[model samples]
Target: MDRYVRSTRRAGGFTLIEVMVVVVIIGILASIALPAYQDYVRDSKRAEAKAALSLVAQRMERCFTESNTYVGCYGGATVNSDSGNWVVSITESAASYQLEADTSAQHSDGECDPMTLTNTGATSPAACW
Candidate 1:
C-alpha cells in the first residue's frame, strides 16, 4: 500500500489572474487621479493669471488716479496676452479695466470671462469688478 503525501511546494509567485486584477485596479485608480490632477492644474493656472493681472491692474489704477482713466497696464513684460496658449489679458474700457483670465487663454475657444477689476482697486479686486 503506497500512501501519497501532498506536494510540498507552495505557490511561489502571483498567478496571471492576480496580476491582471492588480493591473486593472491600478489603471482605474490612475484614471480617477488623472482628471483630478488636471482640474487642479487648471485651477492653479487660473490663480496665477489672476495674481499677475491684479499686479498690473494696481499699477494702472495708480496711474489712472493721478491722471483719470486707465493709463494702460503691463506691456513688454514678455507675457503675451494674445498668445495661442495659456495667457492673460487686461483691456481698458472707457470707465474700467477688464481683467479677463482663462486656464487656456488661447485657442479662442476657452471661457474667457473678463474679470472687470478697476485699476485703483477702489472697489478693489476683492470687491465689485
Candidate 2:
C-alpha cells in the first residue's frame, strides 16, 4: 500500500475577492470622511469671516466716537480677512454702519454666504451668529 501526503505550501498573498473587499471598505470610509472634512473647513472659514466682521465693526465704532462718522474708518486698512477667505464691504452713514462679509472664492457656503454685522452690535441670519 502506498501512503499519500498532503501539500503543506499555501498561497502567500491575498486572493482577488479579499483585495476587492478591502478596497470597497476604504472607499466607503473615504466617502463618509471627505464630506465631513469639507463641512468642517467651510464652518471654520465662516468663523474667521465672523471674527473679521466684528473687528471691523469695532473700528467703525471707534471712528464714530472720535470723528462722529463711520466713513473712512479702519485707517484705510484692507477690507479682507487675514486668511483671505472673506472680502468685506462696508455701507455706512454718519451714525450707523453695516459690514458684510462675502466669500472671497467660489466656495459656496449655503448656510451663510454673506455674513452681516452692524455698528449697533446686530448680526444677521441669527442662527449663524
Candidate 3:
C-alpha cells in the first residue's frame, strides 16, 4: 500500500528537472521574440514621420499655387498637428521647397531619425518610405 501511494503521487506531478527545462525553453523563445517586436515598433513609428512629411509637402504645394511662391506658407510652422510622433518643418522659396519630419523628442532614434521630402517628390533614405 505504501509503495502504491508513493508511485501515484510521483506520477501525478512533474519533476524539478522537467519544470526547469520548460522554463528555459520559454525564456529562450522570449529572448528571440523581444528584439523583433522592438524593431516592428520602431518601424511603425517611422511610418508616422514619413506620413507627416507627405502631408506638409501637400500643404506647401497648395500654398505655392495660391501665391506663386512657397514663402510665408504655414507661417514657418515647425510642428505638425496631424502627426503626433514627428516634428515637421519646411524651407522654401519661390522656386522650390524642402520638407522634413524629424522624430519627436520622446521617440527620437537613429534608425529613422529624420525623413525628408522635397518639392520634386524625392524621398531620402528611400528605403524608409
Candidate 4:
C-alpha cells in the first residue's frame, strides 16, 4: 500500500494590515490635496472679482472723460460679473474713483473677501493681486 501526505498552504491574498496601510496612505494624501484644491478654486474666483472691477473702472473713466464728472455713470448701480461670482461697485467723484469687488455673499471662504481697485489702478490686499 502507498500512503499519500497532505500539505497545508494558504492562498495568496492581501492581509488586513496591508489593506489598512493602503487606506491610511490614501487618506493622508487626500487630506493634503483637499485644502490645496480649495485654495486654487478661491483664487480663481478672485480673478473674476478683479476683472469685474477693472471693467467697471474703465467705464467710469470713459464716462468722466465725456461728462467731466463721475455722476450717473453706471447709474450708481452694482454690477455683477458674467459668472455672477462678484459684485462690483464704484464710489466716484470728479477727481477720483474707488472700485470694490465684494465677494462675501458669493464666496465667503475666499481669502480676499473684498478687493479694491482705484482709478490709479492700485489693488488692495497686495498679496492677492
Candidate 5:
C-alpha cells in the first residue's frame, strides 16, 4: 500500500528535470524566433521607407509638370516617411532632384541606411530597392 501511494504521488507532478527540460526547449525556440521576427520588422520598415520615397518622387513629378522645375516640388517643407521611420531630405536644382531617406533608427543597417532616389528614376544601395 505504501509503495502504491508513493508511486501515485510521484506521478502526480512533473519532476524538476522535466520542468528544466521544458524551459530549455522554450528558450531555444525563442532564441531562434526572436531574431527572425526582428529581421522581418526591419525589412518591413525598409519597404515602407522605399514606398514613401517613391510617393514623394511622384509628387515631385506632378509639381514639375505644372511648374517646369524641380526647385519647389516639395514645397520647401520638411518631409517624413508615411510610417515615420524615415526623414526625407531633398537636394534639388532647376532640372533635377535627389531624395534621401535618413533615420537614426536605421543607422545600424549599413547596407540600406540613407536610401536614395533620383529624378532619373534611379535608386541607390541597390540591394535595398
Candidate 6:
C-alpha cells in the first residue's frame, strides 16, 4: 500500500520575520514618541519652576515693599515657606532686577542655576524648582 504525503506548508500564527517586523515597528514608534514625552516632561518641570519662581518673586516684591530695600541674590534662603523646593534669589545690577528660582530636585552642581532655571530659555529641557 502507498501512503499519501502532504506537501503544502500550513500557515502558522507568526513567523520569525513577522515577529522581527513587529518589533522593529514598535521600536520605531517608541523612538518617535520618546522625544515628545521628554519634551512634555521638560515643559512640566519648567512650568513648576515658573510657578515657584512667581511665588518667590511676589514674596521678594513684598519684602522690598515692606522694608524699602532691594533684596540681593539670596539662594535657597527660604525658611519654612510654601516654596519648599526653591532657591529664590534676586539680583539687581544697574537697571533691571531679576528674580530667579533654582530647583531642589534637579539641582545640578554645574548646570543648575536659578537664573538658568528654564534650561537655555524656552528651547531646552526644564529643571524642577
Off by over 4 Å in 3: 1-8, 11-13, 81-83
Q: What ranges in model 2 sit over 4 Å off?
A: 1-6, 74-78
Candidate 3: residue 38 Cα off by (Å): 1.2
Q: Which ten residues in a row have the lowest lDDT in candidate 1?
A: 75-84
Evaluation by TM-score, superior candidate among 2 and 4 = 2
| Model 1 misplaced regions, further than 4 Å | 1-7, 72-86, 93-95, 102-109, 112-129
Tens digits of per-residue lDDT, candidate 6, 1-129, equal 236876589876989899999999999999999999977765665566666666655655565567664445343354222435555555543323465655675532234345332211331224433
Q: Alpha carbon lDDT of residue 111, candidate 6?
A: 46
Best prediction by lDDT: 5
Pairs that clash in candidate 5:
none
Distance (Å) between predicted and true CA of 94, model 3? 1.7
Local distance difference test, each candidate: 0.56, 0.83, 0.81, 0.82, 0.84, 0.54
Colliding residue pairs in candidate 2: none
lDDT head-to-head 2 vs 6, winner: 2
**Across residues 1-129, which tens digit of lDDT does each residue of candidate 1 receive?**
346867779879999999999999999999999999977765555555566667666677776777776634443232433333445566675467655544443333233343334444533234213
C-alpha displacement of 59 in model 4, angstroms? 1.5
lDDT of 4 by residue, 1-129 (tens): 235655578789999999999999999999999999988988888788878888898899898899988878876588888987788877877778888888656467455767899888898878878
What value does the lDDT take at residue 64 in candidate 5?
A: 92
| Candidate 3 C-alpha error for residue 109, in Å | 2.5
Which scores better on lDDT, 1 or 4? 4
For model 6, the stretches where C-alpha displacement exceeds 4 angstroms are 1-11, 70-76, 79-86, 90-98, 104-113, 116-129
What lDDT does candidate 6 reach at residue 9? 90
